[model samples]
Target: MSREESAAQARLREAAAARIRAARPELADAYDLASAEGLLAVRARIAEDTAAPEHLAAVVIGRFDLASWARATCEFALGLDPEQAAAWRRSFTRTVFLAGNPDNLRERFSFAHFADDGSAAWTDPGPAADSAGLRRLLKLFDGPRPLPVRADTVVEIPPRAGRRPDRPPVHRELHIAASGCRVSDALVHLNHLLAEAVLDGLIRPGDTLTIRHAPRLTGLTDRFAALRVDTDPTLPGRLRAAAGLTEEALLVPHHRP
Candidate 1:
């Protein structure tokens, strides 16, 4: 590609990176962003080997919308059946992101994340003349059972009145089961939904967020812990830096920062 073409492609990546940094700057230090970059590099290598336009486009789209991929991961998990979800909870450990560059236009890329066991294996049919590389990733389980999520329904558990109710707020438990879905998938789905809700301004920074579920079979007490991220005003700036964006664009208020 010509130097001018490369420069144009870089500009497009910068723009997309800007959007992501603005949305979640605190994750700049997280390995997921770096892992995503590595995947993008791999896609580029595949593209160079094959010279496939369609493959390049697919790769770039996957990388450019990294957040969307994470969201998709949750959606996929949430749709699993109860039996499958429970099995996945015990078997899955790592969360992976896959990406590619489709058209070779400015190194554009896209990615999606999946939860899998550490030993899960994948095989790729090296770059096709018309494709990037045929990927055989770990297959995900089927969608969750047909259980409706009632957004307006609030299942209340009354606070215990005996203790120092005034000193420490009474804690009540809410039992929320996935709408006829697998337990593992429901947790992932809920995680992504909550993440998106926070990103979209629907869930405020300090608002109390809770996950209610039956402890008997959910196995969520441990899996759900990793999703906790304290939102700081400076987090967006950090995320921008992680994406190789200039820190000036973060624009967080000083008091909050």
Candidate 2:
């Protein structure tokens, strides 16, 4: 990429990182969990369950809103007064439309995977997402499903507050894009490590980052991402150590529309 293009890219990622850095406490907790032992256990379990990084990434970051909302409504059904239900309905509508798996439609799309190379693997949220979000929620409103008769089931549906991630899970894309060699492996490996850090909680989503992989004199390197992470030339080992990374993998950054 040209110097101008690179600079613009850097700015975009910076904005994302800034948002992540400035996140509220409740939302930050989820990002902070990236490095916790429990999250590590979750990652380990996920790795054991799948051989593909794509599968691992999916489990790490898939946004499961439909099911969560349903459970929440059921638990608070009796408490859902007319106004509360309307509010929830509006919230639920926006959610299901943007994030739910609506079986009612002949064709449905999802952004469950994070796109590393900028290839849009699914239908991302757009300008009309809110109106459509509500419509989609209404379709799935088949009254209430059969809840098991039980005493006081607990429900916790924390509203996803603060700045939401603009894209869905693209962890695999980032990993593959960053797994490169010494010629310019710095950015690639660092980003790959960052993805794990995100899953592990070392790096929060929306935190601006940059890569320092030196471009070849002959041409630009194959390192591209939706948001380029700024890196410190002195602290490569720090990132590696934090993410428990030992090897370097590489790929060219190519965003397919």
TM-score for all predictions?
0.21, 0.21
Off by over 4 Å in 2: 1-109, 113-118, 122-191, 215-257
Task: State the RMSD for candidate 1.
Answer: 19.8
Candidate 2, residues 1-257: lDDT per residue as tens digits? 57854554344334333334332223334443333243344335434644422211111112322223322222223222344333332221112212233332224434333223222122222234323544444333221232222232222223235857443312222221222233123222333334323333323332222222222111221232223233334433111111121122232346999
CA deviation > 4 Å runs, candidate 1? 1-135, 141-175, 184-188, 203-208, 214-257
Give Cα-based local distance difference scores for all models.
0.30, 0.29
